[model samples]
Target: MTDRFRELVVNDSLVDIQYKTDPPTETVSPRVTYDRDDVPHVYCMKKTIPLSAFMERYARGEQRMWLAAYRPSNGRQTTITFAKHDRLTFGKRFIDAVAAERAHLFAPAQDSDGDASAPPPISSKKTAEVSSKAAKKISLEELELSLALQREIGRLGEDAAYRHEYVRLHALDCPNPAEHIVRISEDDVGAGYDMRSTFAGQTRYIEVKASTTRMDSFYISENERDTLAKVGQEAFIYLCRVDRDAPKNSAVVREIRDPMNPESGILLEAVAYKAKLSN
Candidate 1:
């Protein structure tokens, strides 16, 4: 047996044992029982023989054999048994066999070469080149669209009716009206395709789905989905039903929590509202 197996036995790491015959035979094999009263488990190693005469005395119970033991708390441990008659079979190869079986327990030490002591440094020119490339990679069209959405949201503050209604609803909770900023636009802020907001600070990211007709669902973009996950509970969805053909003052607004949920059925009512920012 290798030192690894000995160490495992001493440390009480043995878990379980299993045995199977190579070719079906009727001969009864010897068994080793291991029962520890302190550990509350009983195990056995059966059908194993000594290393001596393992090849020639197969019929006489001298075949090379292995035994596996297990501990309930640890895992499994294997010990090879040699038959008494097989002593000459392993004359010099015993050490080699032990080493081969226990290879996983041993590892060579690292060399103390000076080459591994220090790492190479980066140049200033290389650092500047990387920064320049990163700056150039930003999409101008995306930036312009974001800026346009932001500006449109800013214009909603000038709408007197929207401002008064927002103030009447939110003023009781928020004493400072100046802190509340109303923003309305087809802006992809959190979890919906378009969002409108009265107070960006007190109110979380509000996704707005606007339609001229009554609809059952709305759409959310990939970026909006990611933003919703990032924002978590601080995200909301608002559906604005605006009759562009009717009186402008009669627009209807409805609020829904977690509109991105698949069960919400908002995706069915999605319409193409794509627009680019212009100078």
Candidate 2:
């Protein structure tokens, strides 16, 4: 990362910086500013720091931080924040943060005018209101149909990713492509992975996920987390994003390699668990 700040001050805490890929206009670096807040001070570092460097710094007890990629021309900023929990499971948290940020960044463009091709965007208030009313108004049949459609979309995404991996492996001259790229999801539902393959003489266990619309967050099962813990660097993730209205082939795959470690900057939240009843 290029140091843009001239008068750099090293604080005990780290700041949340914005990584811009574009070239800087001013050759002279700006002075670093310090804030008095107890929480990690916010400083939008305008330099492009390598993800590895950031991970190293974060792991060395530097600070829990957030990174935002800024595209000035488009006025779009994609942010990745790693908290205390994230630092504990760095790999998964970091990948998730970047994936979410990229998802928003790569979201399909909206129509400038009032066009019928896409639905209008909804505000937070409007969305909440609609969600509350949807449960009361939606019939049981409609709910089931909606759920079924969602499942189908997810299935399509997984299939698209599997096909992508197969083609990629075949192109790489991996022997017995069909047998090599096995869909573990079909064979063992509790395996915590969707597929397995050999890449660069190492076995890769992959977990496939799909998102119909742009999303910064997705679900991960406990089994998947356990698999990640057990496999470590051998685990991989393939995120397939497809537009529900577009052709299935139009899906885009984002590959995450060896996404498990304390240095990965992933935050783990306790959302669900099993409980036993006492007599």
Candidate 3:
């Protein structure tokens, strides 16, 4: 039997084996002895029959075995389990799945040419050129429009903050109060445009003017004026008044109702109304 056991060990890695006959309800410690060379020699416990029986079956080729090792950090004795064929098969399938998932996760991104080689230098240069072209350019009309829009945006921002705080403090606010939306100039286009929140909503367009007082009129580009006329009654004009000295939080927003006529390119009488911040 010992010689048969030696043959069974040919392809197996040596491991410490602990065994129990009764089903384990909790962990248990068994006394073990090792040879002077540190090889496990004997296992003694309340149920040593299972370990002996397993060895016998393995030698007779009547059972298969798989070994696993574990080490605990709390200075507790390490443990190894000798699992049978069914458990070993389950463990192998689980390990294979985990390995496949890990390989997929760490897979490298493919290059444009479908190879792993680094991208060409000209590709980077082309990207830089495209970016430079998209950068905003300074034109006289764009510069004037941007300055005006900036002033309006600054004023609207303050008004919004004040209104938000005011509403928070006074809970009895109206169902629909007032709202402000500010956008700065970009793409070398500084014209103000109106956007309706919904298809059925009223149209509101704003042309901002920033000055010491409301005395100076600002320029409205051809495109800006055309957009306003197209929207009809839904269109409105927003006037922002700013003081250069009091730049921070220094402006006020006022709206002028339907201020343009598309068919006749005429400017309608400006009916200025103060912006309400509640909504």
**Candidate 3, overall lDDT?**
0.38
lDDT of 1 by residue, 157-213 (tens): 224334444655475675565455444342423434333344434455555545545
Counting clashing residue pairs in each candidate, in order, gives 20, 7, 3
Better of 1 and 2 by TM-score: 2
What residue runs in model 3 are displaced by over 4 Å at the alpha carbon? 1-200, 262-279
Pairs in clash, predicted candidate 3: 177-279, 178-279, 203-234
How far in Å is the alpha carbon of 184 misplaced in model 2?
1.4
C-alpha lDDT of residue 194 in model 2: 85
Give TM-scores for every candidate, taking all chains together and pairing residue i with residue i: 0.30, 0.47, 0.29
Error of 1 at 240 (Å): 1.0
63-167 in candidate 3: lDDT tens per residue?
123333222223333333333211111122222333343343334458788875432222222122213534422323223323444644445544433443234
Worst 10 residues of 1 by lDDT: 83-92
lDDT of each: 0.37, 0.53, 0.38
Ranking by lDDT: 2, 3, 1
